[model samples]
Target: MKQKIAVLGPGSWGTALAQVLAENGHTVKLWGHNPAQIDEINTYHTNRHYLPNIKIPTSIKGIKELKEAVIDVDAILFVVPTKAIREVAKEVAISVNTKPYIIHASKGLEQGTHKRISEILSEEIPESKRQEIIVLSGPSHAEEVAVHDITTITAASEKLEAANYVQDLFMNDYFRIYTNTDVIGVETGAALKNIIAIGAGAIAGLGFGDNAKAAIMTRGLAEISRLGVAMGADPLTFIGLSGVGDLIVTGTSVHSRNWRAGNLLGKGKKLDEVLENMGMIVEGVATTKAAMELATSLNVDMPITKTIYNVLYEGKDIHQAAKEIMLRDGKVENEFS
Candidate 1:
């Protein structure tokens, strides 16, 4: 069955998702704030600013106005970065009347407020207008998804129906979607793992071999689980697709922006310089601060996150931070309790 889908962002991830939907035989509207990007998608069958090389399908239309994009869509996939989800959602809510199913692909906690993307949407969209509210997440990366690689992700929501609905829309040969009820855990796992990936990248960039990278990835997951559990997420979910699965993929994959940003940081580049050169939003930088603060407020033990927070925000040296973490560890192996 064909559905009208609106992708509420024109970044790489959003464009990739729109491509997937178009491949699934759905009519897709790819919305962007940039007029040139919208024009590229509409007139040239490409998105020059993001996902430059991939050719967009003719079925996927591009729209600059939020209202124009949301019109008559059966599902609206919010694929904006976490930092911008709230603001975009706010703008969307005011003009949207179609009451389409809300599916979010963003992964990060809001800064200062420490609110999850779902929470932000809850506050922004009217209570009566809230859709099933689905979150799509897992080990999938945008670059791979654009090329029609075999990618698996989980579609989760508090409501089982929402998960099933999203699963039906996104599932296909190269793209697999699993349904889960642990929305909180899935979202937290997806958001928090990026921060850990940054640390993993830093470890890799410091000339540390596989062993060090493995340790960083492992310990980073431990901290992510600890904080997530404290915030009412299921611990077992952390070991599943959205948790450890995502950590392994992002921490090691070269496609991860967070990992690349951390690699430059470990190479001794300043934060501003790294950000400027990358020309993309490194979500983990902001997410780390939000996660660290949230963990502190919840009294959760997140030493790895704390150390990364110091290295990124407080100007602590990466090597010094690693040494401190290495020396302070005195715990039994295979015991996560």
Candidate 2:
């Protein structure tokens, strides 16, 4: 069945998703704050700044106004930055008259509140105006997905019916969606892996080889699972697509903003300078602080996360932080036991 969907945010991920939906035969309303971007998408059928050289389907309509985008949509996909989740949800709540399925593809935790993107959406959007909240996440990147590269991801929700609905909406020849009920595990894994990715990028930036990167990724997954399990997530979910799968892609790819930011940091650039140069949000930088706070409150020993947080926020030297992580007391590999 065809449906009208509102895809909020005109970033690369959002644009790529809109294309997918349009290709799937849905009427897509692609929303953005910038009128110029909206105009470009509407007039040229392209979002050059975000998804350059990619042609947006004519079925997708670009809308600058938030209310205009959500007015009669059957579902809303929040693809904005983590910080913008609440603000956008509130606006959507005010705009909609009927309940719509809420789906978010953004991956990050709120800075001060330490809340996941789905949590922020639930809090800000009135329950009366929302049906089911679904999270679509995994190792999929917008750049690859835009060009129809084979990609797989998890669509997780407490409601299996909702997850299946999202799966049906997105599944295609080159795109695959697996349904899961572990929203906590999926969201936690999606947000925390970026911190580890920053460390991986740092390893590359410092001229370290694959061994160091592999170690960081492995230990990083351990820490992510520890904190996630402590917070009521299923332990096994961390090994799945949203967990280890996401960590591998985000930590190693040049397409990852967090990894790119970490690379600059490792190459002797300051945080502000690195962020300025990238001209995009590096979610791991903020997520590192939130994860560090959450780990301390939960008494979870996340040494790698702690090290990354210190380097990002406390003026600690990256080399010293890396050394500290390397010199931490050795123990049995299976800390989960």
Candidate 3:
């Protein structure tokens, strides 16, 4: 059934998802803060800064006003950064009259509170005006998804019906969506993998071969699973699409902003310089801090995350951190489980 959906945020991920929804026969109100970007999408059907080559569907209308996008939508898909989730949700709460399903594709933990995106949404948006929140995540990259490359993702919600609703909305021949009921596991895996991707990129930037990259990826999964399990998530979820799958793509692919930023840092660029050069949110940089704090607070052992955090924030030498990671006291391979 075709329905009207509001896609908040016109970044690469937002625009690509808007395209997918439009192709799936939904009327999309693609909302962005910048009037210039809205005009570009409305006039040229192209978000040149984000998805430069792909032409967006004319069916996707660009809306600058937040209320205009949410007033009559059946669902709202948030593709904004983690930091902006609360503000956006608050704005939507003021505008929305009828309850609409809230789905977030953004992956990252909040900086100070360390709350997941869905939690932030729940806190900001009144329960009376929103349906069960859903999270859409997996290995897919916006660049590839924009080009019609085959991609698979998970739609997770506390309510199976909600997850199935998102799955039905997004599933197609090129894009596949699987449904899962483990919201905590799904969200934790999604947020934590970006940190591992940074480590993977640093390994690559340091000129390490496939062996080193494999080691980082393996141990990265171990630490990710450790923290996730400690935080009340299913241990097995780490091995699924949102966990191992996302780590592989984000860690190995050039399309990942976190990996790209880590690569620059590994090559000796300063964090500020790397961020300025990338001109986009490198989520892993922030997630590294949040994850490290969470792990420390939970008394979970996450050496890899700790090292990456130090390297990114404390000006620790990357080589020394890598060396320390290699020389850490040995443990049973399945200790995390």
Candidate 2: regions farther than 4 A off = 335-337
TM-score-wise, the better of 1 and 3 is: 3
Model 3 lowest lDDT segment of ten: 328-337
Writing each residue's lDDT as its tens digit, candidate 2 over 1-337 gives 8888999999999999999999999999999999999999989999888887998898799998899999988899999999889888888889987688999999999989999888899888878899899999999889999999999999999999999999999999999999999999999999999999999999998889999999999999999999999989999999999999999999999999888988888999999899888877888988999999999998999988988888988999988887887787778998463
The C-alpha lDDT values of all candidates are 0.87, 0.92, 0.92
How far in Å is the alpha carbon of 284 misplaced in model 3? 0.7
Tens-place lDDT digits, model 1, residues 1-337 = 7899999888888889999999999999888888987887888898766676888898888888998888787888999889898888888788787777889999999998999998888788875665778899999888899989999989989999989998888889999998899888999999999899999889888879899998888888888888877888888989899999999999998889999988888888888898898867888989999998998898888888988999999999898998998888588653144
lDDT tens string, model 3, 190-210? 999999899989988998989
Choose 1 or 3, whichever is better by lDDT: 3
Candidate with top lDDT is 2
Better of 1 and 2 by lDDT: 2
Q: Is candidate 1 or candidate 2 better by TM-score?
A: 2
